[model samples]
Target chain A: MMPEKVTIADVARRANVSRQTVSNVLNSPDLVREETRERVRQAVEELGYRVNQAARRMRTGRSRLLAVRIEQTQDGMNVFDRFLHGLTESAAKAGYRVILYSADDDRSEIATFDDLLGAYEPDAFVLTGTHYGDVRTSWLAERGLAFVTFGRPWGMPEGGDHPWVDVDGAAGTAAATRHLLDAGHRRIGFIGWPEGSGVGDDRRSGWVRALGEDAEDSEAGVLERRTDGSAAEGEAAARELIAAGATALVCVSDSVALGAMQAGPVPVIGFDDTPVAAAIGLTSLSQPLSEAAVRCVRVLTRLLEDDSPDKPDHVLLRPSLVIRRTA
Target chain B: MMPEKVTIADVARRANVSRQTVSNVLNSPDLVREETRERVRQAVEELGYRVNQAARRMRTGRSRLLAVRIEQTQDGMNVFDRFLHGLTESAAKAGYRVILYSADDDRSEIATFDDLLGAYEPDAFVLTGTHYGDVRTSWLAERGLAFVTFGRPWGMPEGGDHPWVDVDGAAGTAAATRHLLDAGHRRIGFIGWPEGSGVGDDRRSGWVRALGEDAEDSEAGVLERRTDGSAAEGEAAARELIAAGATALVCVSDSVALGAMQAGPVPVIGFDDTPVAAAIGLTSLSQPLSEAAVRCVRVLTRLLEDDSPDKPDHVLLRPSLVIRRTA
Candidate 1:
């Protein structure tokens, strides 16, 4: 049989201190006198107090739990591994444990959410690789659950109140384009994801915005646009771009960049300085995944601690350019 | 209070079947009639009669648990992730769970082993990246515990009795060398980990064996050899090789290959077609990690079920070559 859960009141009684002192010791250790904190800590250890996590959460009206829901789609593959590494490292340092959950392909969006809610009852959720018209976000929002997503939600106002952290997709692409332009390459081509895909669309916008009329008129400028994020598709896109007379190519991802390099001899740049990009010497933008993960944990922890449902916070991280032999 | 564990007898009584029939349904479903199996399964579900895993293990002298220990060193980084993924996937497919334990440092090795033994009482242990004088392997052998290691133990005989599954490190290196040879490259150089490193030594031996003694001794044929696995170290190694007139480079890992690529225009080939390798298009040898994981589970399971220590089994899987542009 499970042992009885030790409570804050029990600890306070044992330490001959008020419950508020125990609370202060738990939430803000600095505020409590060192002697008082030590006494309470001793009492906690002696009484085997474990803070009754669920009960404490109920009283604070916030959970200490954070749920990261990862979609198992093909495009979502490989990205999660790096993300997981970053998230796990950051979360561990911040004293938060992330519960990983995957959405079943056969389950409806709401059903998936329901199952997760029942299983974990996390305080807040992090939705990675969110798509257009994502129902998961709306369901959580309606239930008044604090949450954040990696990408902007569909139909949400540009400056709307909802916490999110995403890469400046357009700015990253523009940086890549400017790098090529600075290299004296005028006939630069863009091999990117298909139109209507949120992140892809943002990347294309950056390229188009950078090149302006040069991007608009020539069929040669748009080398290949694929809806998929596979190596085979990237290779096909590279071949098409090379045939169209592109002296240099800007790929949507490092994987695509590798494929492009294998497909032809044309110089290429890629996004997301994945280890592969560094390995192959592909000039690309390296996303600060570790920093973003730390920030995500910080923000989520704050929301879980405080009961206010004020304006949501949005964080946009800068992508650094890594120059290599490919470009 | 925790609910009382439902026993096989209770399940059998509810399903109107003998306890032996219930045991057959749980252990070997094929032995029971389909209708009887269905009835027993339904009874199990209704009563929530989970097999008393700990008790069953103790009675049968089979924990059905596979324990893997990884070396805790900077060079051993990333080994755990791949190994865990493979082991977990294989264990789940075979209706078992893998209990993971890690040695934080050399001092914790014995403590880690003790904790794992007491807590899980694993059926078999898999030791990866073991070094000279590894006490863990010898301890398990002395205790008469079934076990395996990725590489042969340092003090053990070449064709020893202990079961092990290993990548043909020599053959993989030879294959990489042959790829460079077939590409009409004679002035090839080797960049690898330090001599004492078992994997490094094995791979370097293959490179030397493939090129012949006289060719390997030539100044142009021997570029640079480094001890570290960091990208910076790789870059420095590559620069040294380039200065020594080495045209093509073979590296110990994808990270080194990436580092070498970042340093200059030299084409690089590496071992382990990790995700990063795929992203960078570095020609690499892809170790059969998933296959080896499955095989480990299969072997461990067989050993657990057979309940005999008469003989040990050893398996070796050949690594495959993945050709990319770096070569």
Candidate 2:
């Protein structure tokens, strides 16, 4: 059975310290002496002192809990899986736990956000896969809730007062294309998803940027192909690109590269550097997911703590090429 | 700023109803008159009524938060992602929120459980990937915590008190083997993980079981090969199995099946029917993960509700084969 509420004064008395020391121990442990911190902690534990969340909130106006939406793509790409793991590890180090929810779409996501806020009382939200004029950010921003996005607010200029972390897809694809170009391949084709997605287009741009300033046939979208981002479709697209005088290929996703690999042993580079690519020895670009996640949490904790005046608002991390047998 | 929590008494006074009626409206609306329920709900909404969790826990002991460990395999298998989605959906229906944590190993997982119990005060936990003499379960059991496993407690007897929902791996592999047998293939081979894991061995046993009940060469691991459950390793082992008279193969995982498919297009069946499997058209057994997740929550809720004596403590649901191009 839980005992009566053990106040900070009680823990302080038990530890033979001032109440402020106990407060510092709980709120900012680094501010307290190590020995005094241990003593206060032992006293708190022995006395079963638990934070009355409401009381603590009213006093310090600070807390730590983040709500994360866990999503899996229809094609079974585990892109978010690695991201979730990285975020969780980083969040734990920062004294936060993630309350996860899944929603069918953005509308339901806002609804779930409302439910989670009321039910779990998370201090902030970590939005993933953000897009242009994203409703979720606007919803939270309108309510004056603290939050950060793991994806760039597409079409929003740098330093738009929105906090986000994103991997530079164009840089990743450009690096991939450059690797192929350095290997003496002139006609490097790009395979990507339908042109509507900002991420897909970003990746396509890098491939074009890597080709010389000729930008002629490449400008015609000459050797480029788009698909629904399936391995089978990738195979077909790869075949078509190969037929059109392309000796090397750059794909927006590992799934397409997988299909492209089946099309021929011709050198190919895939994005995301997923486990599937590694297992099959495919050259690909590895997203800096872990670093990005760490930065996301860093930006978020900075906001919740409100200690820094010039808190970093946006992060665009570069992905690196993992040279393997395929390219 | 959050105001003081609006209690049931406050809502009752606002609604001009008895406190008992207000409690009934909150806990069991079915027991309250419709008109009375509407009045109490409206009053509660007007007052922004928020239950004092600690006080409510003392009175009813029927809280609803389930702690789930979010896990991602090193192989990029998203099996747990689907299971988590199913559990979240089902848990939401039952007014439960899942608090997710990820751990590196069983030891860290136990530490996370202790931390979660202290911080979240969840009513129960949903454990996945149970193994023989699992330390995690023993720790929970020792602490008298309520939990249900998504995996079976290996080596436990049929009527063991542990609550779990597990897909019948043996039956699943047996069905795959039988499908091949019905197609008139003899000397079918089995590819699985290096023989120690309970799940891997369970799948291997299914193939052995469906081998005409000969129980001779099958017992000797003849026509059977083991690998590290990777596609590259699977390919190498498949080649060996094919060389030694295996007309068809049953793989323990989709990754292995992906490898075996590269081994000369031999008829093959994989387990877990992952997204990769669907993308590549690998015939595989689909574990009824959603059904199992739903059942795990059901068992947990039943135990927590404690009104039903006939609680389904142990459940073994059979996995179904999804036929595709590979087979």
State which candidate has the highest lDDT: 2
Which tens-of-lDDT digit does each residue in A1-327 have in candidate 1? 222446688999999999999989988999999999999999977876655434443355343446664334232224455565566556545544454444454245466455445423456777787666666676677677778887766466553357788888888888888888788877777877876778888877777767763554345445556737677888888787777777888878876777788888888888877655655577988777767777777777777666754767778887878999998
User: Which digits, one per residue and each the tens of the lDDT, describe model 1 over residues B1-327?
Assistant: 233446789999999999999999988999999999999999988887766444465456455556654333233224445655677657756655554444555456566555445434556777787666667676666666777777756555553357778888778888887778778777778888986777788888777777774353455345657748888898889888888777788888877887888768766888877766665567898888878887877777777766755667677788888998787
* lDDT for position B6 in model 1: 69
**Model 2: per-residue lDDT, tens digit, B12-32?**
999999999998888789999
Candidate 1: the clashing residue pairs are: A279-B258
Model 1: chain B TM-score relative to the native chain B: 0.85
Which lDDT values do the candidates have, in the order given?
0.70, 0.82
Docking class of 2: acceptable
- Summed backbone clashes in each candidate are 1, 0
The digit string of per-residue lDDT tens for model 2 on A1-327 reads: 322446789999999999989989987999998999999999999987765444454344443568888785677665787887888889989888776778888999998877666545678889888766678877787676788898777776543457789999999988888788778888889999987687888889888777855444454368999999988999999999999989999999999999999998799999888867776778989988889889989998888776754654788999999999998
Query: Candidate 2: where is the Cα deviation over 4 Å?
Result: A1-24, A28-38, A44-63, A157-160, A212-220, A308-312, B1-21, B30-34, B44-63, B157-160, B213-220, B308-312
